[model samples]
Target: MGLGKTLQTISLLGYLHEFRGITGPHMVVAPKSTLGNWMKEIRRFCPVLRTVKLLGNQDERKHIREDLLVAGKFDVCVTSFEMAIKEKTALRRFSWRYVIIDEAHRIKNENSLLSKTMRLYHANYRLLITGTPLQMTRLLDILEDYLMFRAYQYCHIDGNTGGEERDAKIEAFNQPGSSKFIFLLSTRVGGLGINLATVDIVILYDSDWNPQVDLQAQHRAHRIGQKKEVQVFCFCTEYPIEEKVIERAYKKLPFDALVIQQGRLAEQKTVNKDVLLQMVRFGAEMVFSSKDNTLTD
Candidate 1:
């Protein structure tokens, strides 16, 4: 609850602007509930960097879109996904220094219009964050699916487990010197608020739309009270949808040697129309056919 991710981000933006001399018209797209929080964080952390929340009536918002976004009059701009889509053309024109997304469920489904629209905006760096679990069941890779059956490793947490069953799994995970390897979890189920500091490694079998949820899961083992230095891994397939998901999920991350990734941050776009059609068709069929289909198209 007290996590200061907002402050951390402000620090990064400030560092890039002040120390590196890379002044930016950075952008932050968050859910409406938290948009004000982002603005507040900006004022608290880096007041030196002027900012604006992209809102108001069409005329007022349009004025910012055409004038401020182009002139870089503001250091950073915050808006909701609704605003991003409603005002795409105007927002897309300017090449942004960085684009940060909060409650980033929109990008989870590559076929989703919001996801596709988000990819059109040009930025040197992209950051995606979400507060809840987004659609994780994207189009499945037949080849990857086949490989899963042949694989011998993994511990997955089902969504329906009761308190006792869930606690057992958590206990086993945190017991002294356990030998378990790969761990899998539903984002909504296990990625909310749990501690698993015994394990030294984590693999997000599926990426959640919310970066915060994913962070919560990753910290299961790597958070406070963990004895060993942890290693975290996330998977991104080569398919266009999968690739976009991966790109948004990891773009905000800093490199091992460098504190931040700088230069040539191009926004991702949809691939061939043919591939997109096939995926949408397949995903739609899957959704309609199964009563329990939880996969997001």
Candidate 2:
């Protein structure tokens, strides 16, 4: 998803160094393949910030660990997921300014080795970046605290919000020069009864069970009279219940089914309770397999 996540993160580091005087020990854990790109982007965009790459075989890493990898010596440490796990003890020594994870979906399952290893390091702030929608609902749950700490102006509405209050918030958000930067709402609550043509970007942090519900939510920013191109980002998990739900939802659409002669849709039926139950149970096998190997192959 060449969506500039790398550049944006580099810019943030640059801001901290240039403005805040926080020339820091920020650690970035990414895939082995992207480590070079991360280093390149940082040098290309923010050459002033010193960056050290934590990579190589055992002896090379030992050399880096002894000489180049020290606090106050480098602004950022770029490393891969495999290196993080292997050198967890060495990396954990520093209290980082920020621990940023790229391709964060790799840690969607909390039980994963990479996910658990990432938590062993200490950081004032942790940022996870991924194009995929993985555990975005959990991400949204933490935004309130993060936004409050950052003092960012934002408005929110949920099922509990009254119609008048919701409309007022929308009006405030749509007003030009308004300080509001984010509007948080539940899909069912905000899907149909709102128009946010003024909005240019929509982040679907929560995935709806029904595809239509998510589409309607996207239209809030893409309605008539909208000038800018609406960028809709849907955060969904790869496997497990959410993925299965999305798969079932799309398969339910009549247009997705095979249309024979005379526009006759292929024979299909709504997912039954058993099918729904199976979808819910789809990913539980991993948990069970961890306990008893006989439960799954």
Candidate 3:
């Protein structure tokens, strides 16, 4: 998961600042646990950009807004998805150049208020960053497609269509002058949607384990509408857990089974005891295995 998504986000922000001359108020929405991580990344990469973290209660939000509006004071604003939903009214008041959604999968549920709130806001540019873009279900695919390309009408061509037919349709739709509605940086989720004529670039990172994960990751960028010859970058390190997970997924094992196997392997390798114990506890909970089954015991 340490795929430099944060660094890429910072680079995009820097590009906007330097190339596009976009110094307007910008916002980044991420999970609560990652707000500090984002701030750290921004400071490390783009120190010149001013930032305000939206946290605390009503008064805190007011203060954040006041500080942001001050003439030439702050350039960017960062907040958690929770806060963004809570303070949607206040957030909409400020005109934003870019609204970046980190772990955009959080809003994969199209019906969630978080997704609704995000869609309501007006931003000159919207960027979504995530390692696992299609975590929940195929519904996520639709939502992300809409968000990235603003696709108004989307429907499966046919469930029984052969790969050749599917490719032909995608090719036709992705032809030049079709629509400039969507740009995708997906992994497996984009395989069915990848248009070589439309996709600009793709970057692949190596970790260890799952074929499904690997397949999905590649499909994200290797799609049909990609007009330019795709550029793919693969990154790998000694840590092989990610690769292991991918391999297991390819074997058709349930994710839970793979996790248990991984845990056992880690324990065999003398991995952290606490982490192992945590995995054991997790497994016990999954099977509802308990030391004290009786309510009073």
Candidate 4:
């Protein structure tokens, strides 16, 4: 999960600033919880870049805009998803170089107002970053995969009984391809679209367990029409979960699916104290054995 997506975004911004010489204004839309982190990362990586945290009432938003546009004081504007939705009208007033969506999975539900607002914005580049992008749950005896997986049921129709004067109502809405704004780069979302082909690189972090999450995340960059071969960097670790995840990802099993099923299984089962104690004891033994080997002359 700590694969430096934010750092990559900062690097991209730096490239746009130095090589392209196109630094007008940039916006980073992320979760409220992470807006501070984004600001911190920006300050640390690109200290020269001016950043203004946009949050508060209408007047506050207006003030921020004035400070940015009129004074030309800030280079990047960081705002939360809620504020983005509230102040979309004001946000759209300025011409932005790049509009980045961190934790872009918040827009998974295209019907939501947040999604609508994000789609309405005009920016040169749109980047989406997240660790988990799909929601899969079981209800009423069916396995349903929403969004990225391409399985969605909009409505149900009733049949006419014996042709007795009856009219059927129709319900419709745009599918996944409705708004073609988001370009996903994640270890949680899976697959890529046929027409979608603009990702440059996908970095994968190493783990102890089967990396179903990382594999699915890589697909977001490697779908059909991708101009270049997706460069995947797996940062392997010594953690047990990381190791197992990497092994499973190599085996080609959907990481999220395994996590979901296993989560459900754990929820439905009861914990075994003796078995857990034995496993803990085994871990302790391994740790002590390693220490003993290191101490010997």
Against the true structure, what is every candidate's RMSD?
A: 22.3, 15.7, 15.2, 14.9
Q: Is candidate 1 or candidate 4 better by TM-score?
A: 4
For candidate 4, write residues 184-203 as lDDT tens digits. Answer: 22222233222234544544
Candidates 3 and 4, the one with greater lDDT: 3
- In lDDT terms, how accurate is model 2? 0.80
Better of 2 and 3 by lDDT: 2
- TM-scores of all predicted structures: 0.46, 0.52, 0.50, 0.47
Best by TM-score: 2
Which ten contiguous residues of candidate 4 have the minimum total lDDT?
165-174
lDDT of 2 by residue, 1-297 (tens): 887889989989999999999988999999999999999999899999889999999999999999999877898999999999999999999999999999998998989998899988999999999989764355455676688899999988766678898889999988989999898776776675798878998887666777677777778888787999887765555544665665555544433332222254234445567755664555454333443222122
Ranking by TM-score: 2, 3, 4, 1
The digit string of per-residue lDDT tens for model 3 on 1-297 reads 898888877887888788988776888999999989888988989997888888878887787768654547778888999999888888888778899998987787889989989999899889888888453344445555666585453323424457776666566656667653433333444445544445555444332244455455555555554445666544433233443443344344344555657766765765566765665565334323433321111
What is the lDDT for 79 in model 3? Answer: 92
lDDT of 1 by residue, 202-259 (tens): 6666776555567777767766788888877666554436555644544333231122
Clashes of each: 2, 2, 42, 17
Which candidate, 1 or 2, has the higher lDDT? 2
Q: lDDT: which candidate is best?
A: 2
State how far residue 182 of model 1 sits from its true place (Å): 14
Question: What global local distance difference test value does model 4 have?
Answer: 0.60
